[model samples]
Target: MKYFVTVQATQADYEAMEGTESPGPPRWSREELLAMVNFMGELNNELAASGELLDAQGFTAPAEARFVTASPGTEPVITDRPYAAADVQPAGYWLLECVDLDRVTEIAARITQCPTPPGSPEHPVVIRPIGEAPAP
Candidate 1:
């Protein structure tokens, strides 16, 4: 089964991220970051060897992004940054094609160990199965 694991963040959490002008503190030491990446790489390699992981990538922060919104009978509004009502933003995500939910949960836990800004513990990695496409 294919699953999408979304890493969610609160508004305050989003605001606290490192921007281009002001890179924040390192969540992990250089060595630690390397180790984490290596670990994840190993996991991915293993999964690929077993023919499980379809694809995976670590995303850049949203500060380097644009936001767009649309409403009925109106032109789409494009903005420089994400617009949220005080409590919602997607921090990152991963797509995993696994054999079962148990495997997906294990992968999600591993991905959650990726670093985050200080003082934010509620940012959780959520995993959900992708449904089959509707018949024509």
Candidate 2:
């Protein structure tokens, strides 16, 4: 089965990370961020070694959107749409092909334990198995 792991952060957490001056806390130091990246890469390498990694990547933030409403007789109104008014936002994701759900969960757990950069807050990594398609 294939799985997708999504990482999300709260707004406060995101803000706290924004001005980090070093990897430890003041700001995310280059080394700290690199360490995190290295850890992720190591995880990918381990998955590959186990013949489970299919594909993975860190994603850029999504574009902003506005919700608009229009009346039958009036122009539409526009309003910014927030994700549940939560401070957290999705930061990255990973995709993996595993033999079973247990394997996927294990990998996600390992990732959760990896260290985060100073400015970067630890976000929950969501793991969900991908659905299989019906035969054509």
Residue 37 local lDDT, model 2: 77
**Ten contiguous residues minimizing lDDT sum, candidate 1:** 18-27
Top TM-score hit: 1
Query: RMSD in angstroms, candidate 1?
Result: 4.4
- Superposed by TM-score, candidate 2 places the C-alpha of residue 110 at a distance from the truth, in angstroms, of 0.4
Per-candidate Cα RMSD to the true structure, in Å, reads 4.4, 5.1
lDDT of each: 0.65, 0.68
Model 2 agreement with the true structure over 23-113: per-residue lDDT tens digits: 3334545576577778988888888888887777764433354578998999999987665324566666777888888888887888887
Candidate 1 on 1-136: residue-level lDDT in tens? 8998787754444344423112333233456546656777787788778777777765554555677799998999988785442445566566778889998898778777765445445557788799999999
